[model samples]
Target: MSNNPMNMMFAWMKIASSYNQMMLSSSEVIVRRTMMMASGTMTLPDAMSMMMEKGTIYATATERAAVAMASGADPAKITAAALKPYSTKTQSNVRKLRG
Candidate 1:
């Protein structure tokens, strides 16, 4: 019962754009990190130790970056408060989908 089909289409387009931005941003971060790890710039043990020591910070930063991308916020500022999370064991509602 909507009067404006064009408006609805535009809204959907905006949502698609937001999702595309989020995917691209997340993929970029993942690919960059993978490249660093694969390039042997850091030893496996060193990387593991660093991740173990800073796992929570890394997770928080990644989540914030994804949210910022989806919301169309400036990527530069996403890490400004990423280390604010106090703990790493926070519960998530995301569930795996089964085909």
Candidate 2:
């Protein structure tokens, strides 16, 4: 039942649809949980802490992916390669942002 390119596309589409639904459900959960905190004995600091926890989880996951991608390079080599054009481009971006 898996002998065609069209079938592969359909399979991937099904996976993507499920993934999107999961993301929507997760956002709905955050909205619901935060709503109760907004009216309860929770302080602003507590809400911020929850938000920060979610942000850090995503940040660390992204960092881990980047590390995995860079795993083939030695640390010093990777640092030098990244810095070669990145530093100048970052400065250019900062100037563009300021303007």
Candidate 3:
């Protein structure tokens, strides 16, 4: 990313937007999963798989953040890098669940 002030500000705005979208999608996933469980549509294996998927996602993000920090990236860049996978996954999940 550009180190120019304006560019950094825009990057931050994008990051903020991504975070907001991720959160909204995450909440929708939670609610949908909960409803499925309540309706007996969600099996134990499915719940386990979801949990594992979330753990893997978190682990990937943490690894990326660690690598970014080790490379001495600026905080904004590091955060953006770390949040990338989460934002991508959540948005994908939202689309898939909706369909």
Model 1 worst lDDT window (10 residues): 90-99
- What lDDT would each prediction earn against the true structure? 0.49, 0.51, 0.86
- The TM-score between candidate 3 and the true structure equals 0.85
Model 3 lDDT tens row, 36-56: 889998878868977888888
TM-score to native of every candidate shown: 0.37, 0.39, 0.85
Clashing pairs in 1: none
RMSD of each: 13.2, 15.8, 1.7
Q: Residue 82, candidate 1: how far off, in angstroms?
A: 19
Report the lDDT tens digits of candidate 2 across residue range 31-90: 655665776955677568656755555555456546645676433333334333323333
By TM-score, the better pick of 1 and 3 is: 3
Give per-residue CA lDDT, model 1, range 7-77, as digits (tens). Answer: 65665565565555555554554555566678856567746754674566577767977786677654333
Per-prediction backbone clash count = 0, 0, 0
Which residue pairs collide, candidate 2?
Answer: none
